[model samples]
Every structure is written in structure tokens, then in C-alpha cells.
Target: MFSRFLVFLLFSCRSLAFEDTYVIGAGDTIQISVYGEKELSIDSLNINSSGKFEYPYLGELSALNKTPEQLKAEITQGLLGDYIISPKVRVSVVEFRNVYVNGEVKKPGGYEYQPGLTVDKAIALAGGFTDRASRSKVYIAQNGSDDNKNKVKLSEKVLPGDIIVIEQSFF
Candidate 1:
């Protein structure tokens, strides 16, 4: 029984680990900068539905399935090897994909996700919960691989593209 409990604890901790990298998604805005290359810096470039961006000097580049760091490295290499010498590149996400919040909230709709958003914060952004909201039972549907599916009873951390459903309180 003790060994079983230990195993459960380990698994629980592992499941709570947040993903270190953000997958480029549609509607996200990215900022690309090349050190000392003011003409090449692009700010607030929207990621199209195809996850591609029209980067300066680089033409079109696919950002989907790539992390910000990875994208930065790729852009740097492309510029240095082909265009500029010793290009220093940096990439940052200015906006994330919208997340949907529905059921029992005062305003049920899509909300923009900020860094480190929690379920409670999301509810507040939707103008708080209605009187009939079941605060104890909140459901979240995350978009990603099958292994990412979670049916959290009361999760604080909420990711982009997550669908949050608040049931009606029976009381």
C-alpha cells in the first residue's frame, strides 16, 4: 500500500508539469528582432491560419510545430548563412490564441489568454460567474495530443485554446 501511494504521488507530480514550450497557433502575434538590424525587425506579425509569417528578408516561414526559441534559431541561421553575417535573432509571443469559456458564467464567450492564466482568473475575465454557477465542478478541455486530455475537477492553470465549462450549482 505504501509503494502504491508513492507511485501515485510521483505520477501526480509529473502530470502537473507545465509544458515548457508554446506551440505557434493561429491568431498569435509574434515579434521578431535581429540585433542591430532595425530594418529586419518585425513586430506584431500575426500568425496566419496556416501558421506562417511573412518575415522580412526571409520571405514566408512556417512557425507551427516550432517553439519560440527554435524559430529564433532557424531565422538566425537562415539570415546569417544567406543574408547577414552573424545575425542575432530574438522571438517573442505578443498574443496567444483565444480560449473559450462557456456555461454558467455571466458572459460566456472567447477570452484572450495571458501568461500564467488560471481557471479562476479566466472566470473573472468573463465577468465572473452567474448565481447558478457550480464553482466546485469546473471542466476544462485542452487542445493538443491525446495524452494532454484532462478532466480536472478544480485546476488553476489554464492553457490556450482551453474550453472551460462551469456547471449549474444544484444547491
Candidate 2:
């Protein structure tokens, strides 16, 4: 049992790193840094509803569905030559999109997403399950996808912008 628990713990930690490969989307805030160029750096830059943000020179660059490194590359390429001979661009996600919890949760609403967020933790943030909440009927609908709602367990990791629904228990 101890070994099983240890494996589970390691798996959970490893799964949490999925955010590193997370696709940038609307409602996510990102930070862009250019080495030794304070004026070119931006902090807490929120991606607008259109999934685009205005950079210093690369006006209105799109960020939707792009990884941080991809955006960094775009910035670096854009700033090279005319803007800067050697642009050291760095892009990092400062804030992930909110995870929404609704249905049978006590305080159903959207909550800020954390790196290691799981179904259980997300429910806790929404004030936990109510009396009518059905633990077995929990479902998740990933943000920005056409996939149908999928059943999820308490231990399942919740990604940023995921919508969690706790169905009512008839019992």
C-alpha cells in the first residue's frame, strides 16, 4: 500500500507538469522578458478575449493555441536584425485560465487554476460538494474543445479553463 501510494504521488507530480506544454489561450496571462531590455519586457500581460496581445513592435500578435516557447521564438525572430541584433526573448505563463465549477458544488463559480489542480482540489476551492452532489457523476468539459463531456474521478488532474460539473445525487 505504501509503495502504491508513493507511485501515485509521483504520477501526480509528473502529470502536473502538463502545464509546461499548455497551449496559450484567452484569459491566460503571460509575461514576456527581453534580456537587458527593460522597455521591451512586459509583466502580467493578459491575453485578450480574442487570444491576442500587442507587443512593442510586433503589433497584435496572436497567442491562441501556441506554446510559450513558440511565442518566444516569434518574438525573437520579429525583434532580430532591425529591432535588436541578438534578441533574448523569454515568455512564461504568469497566470493560467480559471477553472469553473458548477452544479452541486456549494459555492459554484470559477476559481483561479493552480499547477497541480485536481478534481478534488477544484471542488474544495468551490466550497466543496453540497448535500446533493454526486461524487460518482462528476464530469469535465475541457475548454476550447469540441469533445463531449467526460466522466472524471476525484484524483484526476484538472487543467486550466476546464469546466467541472458535479451532478445531483438522487439518493
- Candidate 2 lDDT over residue span 1-171, tens digit each: 999999999987775466458789889999999999999999778987788777887798998999888888999999999989999988889888999998999899999998778999999999999998899999999883528689999999988889998999999
Pairs that collide in candidate 2 are: none
Q: TM-score, each model?
A: 0.79, 0.85
lDDT of 2 at 164: 93
For every candidate in turn, the CA RMSD to the true structure comes to: 8.2, 4.8
Across 133-159, the per-residue lDDT of candidate 1 in tens digits comes to: 898878787853335555565547887
Output the lDDT of residue 54, model 1.
74
* RMSD value for candidate 1: 8.2
Task: Give the C-alpha lDDT of model 1.
Answer: 0.80
Q: Give the Å error, residue 73, model 1.
A: 0.8
Query: Could you give me the TM-score of model 1 versus the true structure?
Result: 0.79
TM-score of 2: 0.85
Between which residue pairs do clashes occur in model 1? none
